[model samples]
Target: MEENDVLVTVEGLSKKFCKDLKTSLWYGIKDLISNIQGNKNERLLRPKEFWAVKDISFELRRGECLGLIGHNGAGKSTLLKILNGLLMPDAGKVTIKGRVGALIELGAGFNPILSGRENIYNNGAVLGFTKQEINSKLEDIIDFAEIREFIDMPVQNYSSGMKVRLGFAVAAQMEPDVLIIDEVLAVGDLGFIMKCFKTIDNLLDNTAIIYVSHNMPTVSRLCDKIILMEKGQSLFQGNQVGKAIDMYYGSFVENESNIVFTNGSIELLTIDLLSSLKMNDNIHEIKWKDDLLLYFKFKLNLYIDIPIFRVLLYDKEQRPLAIFEPNYDENLLKNNNGFLEFTIKHEGIQLSKGIYSINVTAFKRNSNEPILRINNVLSFQIIHDEDHFQPFLLSSTFSTK
Candidate 1:
């Protein structure tokens, strides 16, 4: 790689976690005793280690957007924390060519008790920005977040969405050489999200983005490369974004068999589509007006009165478009299976011929709500006929009618 091209290099990076509660408690006491005894190794009782990230190596070049994808608890966030200097790897090393800016959590370093303006200064200082530098960017940050009126209020008083907007605005304006983002795209309103994407797009010329998101379409559009990670191991690493996405989806499907949960009395047995589904050239194609059906089978180990289920749909931009619940009565008592299903039909959606996600939920019939909820539960694409020949996007002309 050219001298300027190579931005970040990670080598043999490994992070181990401890699983034993008693051992952890013992170690804590031992450390206290060791501090009194002045013995460094006195507290060291070696317990078995759980490797969250094990011996993963990769090179990220400047101006390249790298998409990191994995299931929950799959070590994606751990890797980002290590890269952002929040956590140190137990083994191996990470080297960066320039200053780092990270958006790991919404309002991560913000003090809840402090005003938004105070937190901005505090966070900016932590990010290596001088007081003078923060002063210069203060107006821009406030303007971008569009929260000028609430700038003097404590961040704890801000709504979840407002906090996300302000936090993202600050991080994006930092203009670091290496930017590490973890699911920040999952926040904010649609207009703010579009603004975030544009800011990221503008930074693509000088920054190396390590983007961790659940939106695959956004990943495909923004990232120059993709990395598929599973169970703390890098499964695939290359510039082939499409193949990596396919691998991610395949892993998701393979792991479906492992979703059998014994925690609650209800168990999700099977989930499948009603219509014939075809994924064409990395794009799922379904008839424009077909109703989306989901078949679900669950076994109830305990007697419960009134179970409720909710199904939701999200556009490619991750906006909630619709929510569905099956029409049922007070007769849904006891545990039965084989004939429970839900359906969704979007009459308001005037798609520009693209893919969309379907989210689902399952709860008790009446008494206790939200038994099981699933997001991005299903996916389908809409295809417009060639002869219809209308601008296929959601615009004034199409939606106004």
Candidate 2:
């Protein structure tokens, strides 16, 4: 990876923002006045100003994919905007070597009143493609978007999913030197997303990619390097993508407070972890081969028929790792006036040697409303005997409850 192969570079990048919209607008006006009055040293920020991203630096080389993972409002989007030239950095510089294609937001660079067909040509033109060049790839774009029937319809009339399909298709087909994709691509169906990934994989030979997402598995699959963002800055960036993703999830889980939901009839009281694989009855740590049992206790204030218990497994970072549920007796909800205890048992645990957490909830099957939801109710550490350098894979199955 020589410096000449570099497609993107950032130096001392910083962006600041105001929580108040009025304050931001006023600041903008003040800066404009100061610029007009020949004052380059305008106030960096007035009251309530904070850096969205501060002193971030990174580089992307040809044929490399950099993943950005962070929680909402963590400045991932803000940094992407700066890279895509949608927003300017308050300080520092970004250098790009080639044409940039981005799927940053829904209908981001499209005109609402223009038809999809027209927008295709418009985007191509913006990329300096002649009418003939656009016309040649036009069918492939429409075919990939799967919107040929509605290609002539105005973009404003398209559904959100349809717009996503078109946006990703155009950006992928352009095959620019640098491609930026945000989470909006997830708005498409699974099949479409798979197709998009295939296209991205094909582009990996030459195009540099900056992928922003909360999906760790996808990051593991696509990124050559990973960046964990916090408060608009790069908290961590390294080739250890898996560990970086774990940290990203950890940041989210650590900030969450344990509070029981009480609006519904049934409320969860406590959750316990038990195992039969070892002599210890109640334990917070488990071996890789252990049989684990989840003990759930909840109380009912009103009758709720056919309540469904949903259990979500998360890695140390609180990112959703898996979900397991067992069948329960329907008769238990008949009275719904007394406390209930249930056990969910599992065997053949296949997971990496690290800390994992659980989030369990109960709700009526008929409605999506939750009777009770708990986030990171309890955490357990998994001890394994495998070599630490080996790849981590967790495979487990639930036994009959």
Candidate 3:
């Protein structure tokens, strides 16, 4: 796009926030005093102050869609509010051309006691729409919102989904030159989401859009470019949506907690879950398709003639994801009087890049009854890899010494 076609330009944008309320009030009072005294010095943060948004820059041209993605409190909302002129930046400049339609927060400009129809007028006036213009689009807005039945009803009685639908419909139908949307669409019903996407698809020809959503799939589908934010800074920005998503999901793998149960029929001794770039070298993490290992020790309470071993895998929601039977057919446990050892080695562990529960269980030969079941006794994660095998061996001796 040409320079003249650039609709939004942000340069060195920064915003600061106090971490404590008392300190913030004090700073405000002190700053007010300083202003009265004409101090005219540089503004600096005092104790317990922090930057909510550091230096960040980006641009959007006509007919372009830019996506802002990050975890909560990553300064995306602050940036959007600044772009829409609702808030001022502490430093740097934001130049946005043409009329802007912002559906920032769900029911942000709306009154609870006001009817939906009345809210439509109030919001339109707030967004700089004339009475005749709002009247022209009134039927289309109501039709698009699918809230005709609730048009005269007070919005305080509306459900969250209903509010989202009405708010989106008004913001979309007003025909602004630039559209800025936060994560409010996440609360919309599926049908309304489809309708809104269709409307947005139609608007892309003439409007510039800034979208912020944690829904990666949708962002990948809609945005021409994506910017990743971390700790209030612009960490990455590019056109490779898949690569960006990989980094996004990979950042979350190491922070999961492991849950183990020792009171079951089988008592787990120790579990070893590691990933590496090569064999026998233990690294805390590795890229996709790196060497992996899963090893553990457990004891059998009672003596069994022949026992079969199994491992059950589950997701964070406690739903079963996959199961592995390692020493089921082979008679690897000739001596079952003491502790048993298990080892699973693979060139690259295959998983969808998330934490999963690794459960170990056992059963007697020629019987459906499980001799032991260890539920969620082990867990592991795949940063980005997938494929392996099953390996489990029974140990012969048991002694703490």
Candidate 4:
């Protein structure tokens, strides 16, 4: 791409923060004096100072979207703030070719005491829009936000969702050259979020965007380039969005088993993934079409007839995606020498490529009461060539004329 095509450019961008307020003030005074004396050293870290963002660089061309993803406090927000001109980088520079619109934080650009209507005009003027332009887009913004009735109300009274909706509507409707969005969109309801995404899709053709989010599906849907960050450093940056997403998912520490409810009659001795290959003691790796087998051993304190066992699969977000319940068979539930041992086998697993966790529940046959309910008993990953947003990857035939 030509240089002129690039709408946003960042080079060696770095920012640091001091952990102690008193120390920070002292350092600030010293730095000011050093700069006045023409001997400032911005790169050196003082005591209690840490780099929040360090040496991160990327270029955004018009019509391209970059996904900035990481765990909380990974400096994604700090990078966005620098790009949006909310904060200046101590060691690098950022250049933008056009007007920038940002919704980095909920109610960030709004005056809390001002009505939404007045704030809209203020934000528009900040973006260099004339009164005529703001008037032309006012109705569209109010309608898109779905807050027409509350447009005249003070912004401080708006709920988080309301603020997100209004903030996004104003930012998106103005259609600035560079748009920066943070995870504030996660606060909106599902319906409004869909609407906001549709607006983003429409805006992509004429704008360059920097989107920071933890929702992998949305990132996969929108971003053409991905950057994986950890500890304020970019661990991976490339067009291999799927691989970047995998790394992000890999960084998550498996949740420890949380027993929601349990009876004294049953004790879970061990649960293991019966696999030839293992990622670690806690995680197993398998191909997409491979059979998944889970072995369970439970000590039976009291002999209960026909105990029912259930296995639930959950995505990385902890949303339950699938459930497995074996057919009723008295022989399968029988106690073997004071212990219950069995294997739950899933033939040709159809789940899409991603990390998943297992949840197990045991109950008395035909009873609603659970003998044991446990979460995050086991975790696993399915390797696949392609990433999918849906939970299942079913086999289907395709044809074209």
Candidate 5:
């Protein structure tokens, strides 16, 4: 694509956040005291200059969808804010050619006290639509939101999902030149999400999409290119969406130590996949009968009590499918040097083919509560196969809908 085809250009963009600058009880108290004393000096110490996005630069071509992937604190949201003019960068230039509409945070622009119908008009106004324009689009927005009965009700009365639906309807109907979305797809049911995706796909021709999500497979499917962020810097930018995802997760797990088990307690230190294992890996691998071992190393911290290590699997919808916590004898684990291992046998793993997360919990002998617990330890996938599975083999065919 020619350089002139670029619709969004970001150069040396950076953002900073400060722990001290956060709004806390102490900060609120300090601000109150400062106001009382008329002390302007304390305001100087409020803190800025902590870059959340550091020297990040990239160009997004027209009609191209760019995915942003990163860990929680990474500058994904910060960069999105800058691109949408919600937040200005500390030291960089961002140039955009078209009218931008965003679905960043759910209900970000809605007034709680206002009726849903009123909020739509308010948001439409902010997007440069006049009253007549909003009036013309009101019926369309209401139809898309599927909130006909409650449109006149106060927004505070709406559920979170309803709020998202209304907010998305307003933005989507605006027909902006660019769209920025951040994980709002995570809300609502699967059917609703699919409808929204279909709507956006139909509008993709004239719009450059900037999407931020932790769901790597979805990103790979929808985005033409991907950008990986870690800490405050862009780690990778490439068309090979898979490579960017691998680098992003690889960077994520680097600092964490693998699990170690000792005594009678097993501690799952690190849960990572083989080089072949990726976020985009098939969902069949996550099934009950998959050959791939969930390689986990646990440590028995103390031998005073028996330990039971459990692996729980949940589907993409976060519904618990199966649980395995084979209890081993105290004598079975003699060494406490952190080299104990456990495997979830493939005999009875029953899950439909889709993405799943593994949650780990360790319980002590006869104790109702777990001594060590970690939620969402790892995630894996299962793939579709033409052959109907043998009894012990994982099933291939499953539908996302």
Candidate 6:
């Protein structure tokens, strides 16, 4: 990419905030005075102050999308604010070449008392659009937002979904050189969100986008590059979008199982993943089509006639993917001195390349009541040469005429 092709450039950007309101105001006054005296040191942190965003740098060119992803309070929002010029950085600089459209927060640039139509024009004007330009796009915005009936109502009366629809429609329809979108699209309906994504796809060749989202699937679908943030710092930044997403999910893994519901009748003793490649003490690595073997040991407090066992698999986002249940007649649970041991074997697993977790449930024969239900008993990563967003990677043959 050439130098002029880079529409947005951020270098060594940093911002800090004081935890205490009174102290923040006092420090603000002191900093203003020090700046007047030409003796201010923005790099040093004062008492009760911490960096909300620190030393973050990236360049965005036309026809590319950059994704910012992290947990709440990880400074993703703070970085967007800085990029949209809503907050001033204590250090570093940002350079942009053309008009910028942003929808960082719900109802951010709109007046509550104003109607939706008025706010649309107001936002367009802020983006340097004249009356004729706004007029040409007015019907398109209303149609895209699907709020033709509610366009004349005050913005305060709009629901969260309505506000998001209108906000995104205006920001995306403006066709600005650079677009900054936060997580506001999460509030819109699925159909509307799909429409917004299509619009983004259409705009990608002419616009540079900075997108912040918690939905990994959408981020994976749209972003060409990814930045993972943690505690006001960049944990990972590069074109490896899949790896960055994996790292984001890895940060949330729990060390121990979460018992959802358990009766006094059974106690889980030990659960282990029978894999040759162990990523850590807890996570195992398996090939794409290899068999998945799990061993379990349980202590029965109160004996039942027949016990049923169920094993479920979940993706990185905790969505249930597959389930395994053994035939009651084939595999009988034998108890020796109130202790039972069994193994569940899944032949020819077809999971794609990603992290997965195991969930277990036990119940009495022909009963809906559960003796034990636990989540995240064991976690594993499937290894493959290529990454896929789908849960399963089935073998198929392709032909063309």
TM-score of 6: 0.90
lDDT per residue (tens digit) for residues 1-401 in model 5 = 34337889999887666666455456568657866986534122245335688888888877889999988988898899899898756567899987888877655568999999899988887667899999999999999889999999999999988988887787777676778988887888787788889988886777888999987667867888888888889888878776676565544332222233323355555465442234543222433444556666765665545456677775543457677646566565434454666455554354444445666767665764577677667766554332111212444688898
What's the CA RMSD for each of the models? 10.2, 6.7, 9.4, 2.6, 10.1, 2.6
TM-score of 4: 0.90
Whole-model alpha-carbon lDDT for candidate 3: 0.72
Overall lDDT per candidate, in order of appearance? 0.71, 0.77, 0.72, 0.84, 0.70, 0.85
Best by lDDT, which number?
A: 6
Instruction: Rank all candidate structures by their lDDT, best first, as comma-separated numbers.
Output: 6, 4, 2, 3, 1, 5
Candidate 4 on 197-250: residue-level lDDT in tens?
888899888889899999998998899988998878899998888889888887
Candidate 6 local lDDT, 331-377, one digit each (tens)? 47678789988888888788989889989888787765788899999
Candidate 1 — which residues are off by over 4 angstroms? 1-4, 25-47, 254-401
**Deviating ranges (above 4 Å) for candidate 6:** 1-4, 34-42, 109-115, 126-128, 279-281, 326-332, 335-337, 397-401
Q: After superposition, how far is residue 242 of candidate 3 from its true place, in Å?
A: 3.4
Give each model's clash number: 10, 5, 2, 0, 30, 0
Specify the poorest-scoring 10-residue window by lDDT in model 6: 325-334
Per-candidate TM-scores read: 0.62, 0.74, 0.71, 0.90, 0.62, 0.90
Location of the lowest summed lDDT over 10 successive residues in candidate 3: 386-395
Model 5 compared with the native: what TM-score?
A: 0.62
